[model samples]
Target: MLNKDCHHNCNQGNCPFAQDSNNANRYVCLKCGVEREINRYPSGFGSIVMLLLSLFIASQLLINWEKQDNQPQSEPAISSLR
Candidate 1:
């Protein structure tokens, strides 16, 4: 059972009454009792933000790796026989 906060009339037998499953966006219709997936954020802004954030983190890691690879290594100390 979801929050049941929806308060819209079913003009065409499509009023969302309950969720189809737990942690799912699909909802059951009130008039016809049909399960339908709902996209509350159809713009997909969250996905875009996550993608950008991932790309930024990946780029930072790559830059750090390249810097480490380009650094010059120290020469080993040699001991001379007395």
Candidate 2:
């Protein structure tokens, strides 16, 4: 079991680890005895999703670049004014 204290500084409401600390709000992790801001999303899932998305996007971009490079460039049309 982890013990947590909330100092009531969080405006997000319904914080699981917040307690009223007189006039100021602070967060304390009961398990580790560390005080800090809590993130809205869990770190593990967010990091994994971001990593996969980046890899997919990068691969798509690389494929497009390779296709473009393999294509021959056409000469520009000559202007009569030149």
Candidate 3:
């Protein structure tokens, strides 16, 4: 069974984990341990994905802005006399 005191941000007023720790029990805190493990070795995929997503958004905005700014020039001011 998991120690209630070891839960992430445990706030139970009567958690045994806190009492156990206070009594000098050295059992590891699984919640904090798992978080540390994940932080210590997060996957590279997320970073790559975020970078690509931002670049794609910027490119799309640029394309839209360019289209808006590139209005065609008006026809020649003078045409052959009818």
Candidate 4:
């Protein structure tokens, strides 16, 4: 069985895995010696994705604005001369 799942059959108040004294992000199973790391903050991958998404949206808005600005205005119709 996986060390992470070691507590599956453990009692409600009892678990084999405990936090490592040196690292708060690590959890070790006393029975199997398996370790896992916890991530409190997001990774750089998420930041990169958000940055790209925002840039895409900003570029689209700028393109639409420029199109509106470049469109020609309607001219008044000239009356027919007698």
The most accurate candidate by TM-score is 4
Global fold similarity of model 3 (TM-score): 0.37
Instruction: Give the local distance difference test score of model 3.
Output: 0.54
Candidates 2 and 4: which is better by TM-score? 4
Model 1, position 52, has a per-residue lDDT of 99
**Candidate 1 local lDDT, residue 28:** 77
Q: After superposition, how far is residue 13 of candidate 4 from its true place, in Å?
A: 15
Q: What stretches of model 2 exceed 4 Å from their correct place?
A: 1-41, 76-82
The runs of at least 3 residues in candidate 1 whose Cα sits more than 4 Å from the true structure, single-residue gaps closed, are: 1-40, 79-82
- Tens digit of per-residue lDDT, candidate 4, span 1-82: 3545554544343447889899887887675666667865658867999999999999999999999999998999999999
Off by over 4 Å in 3: 1-41, 72-82
Query: Ten consecutive residues with minimal summed lDDT in candidate 3?
Result: 32-41
TM-score, every prediction: 0.45, 0.43, 0.37, 0.51
What overall lDDT goes with each candidate model?
0.72, 0.63, 0.54, 0.75
Winner on TM-score (1 vs 4): 4
Alpha-carbon shift of residue 60 in model 3 (angstroms)? 0.1
lDDT of 2 by residue, 1-82 (tens): 2323535533333334544375234576443444554465567988999999999999999999999999999999988985
lDDT order, best first, reads: 4, 1, 2, 3
Cα lDDT tens digits, model 3, 2-82, are: 344554563443322322343332333434432112234345877998999999999999999999889786787886897
Flag the better candidate by TM-score, 1 or 3: 1
**How many clashes does each candidate structure show, in the order listed?**
0, 6, 0, 0
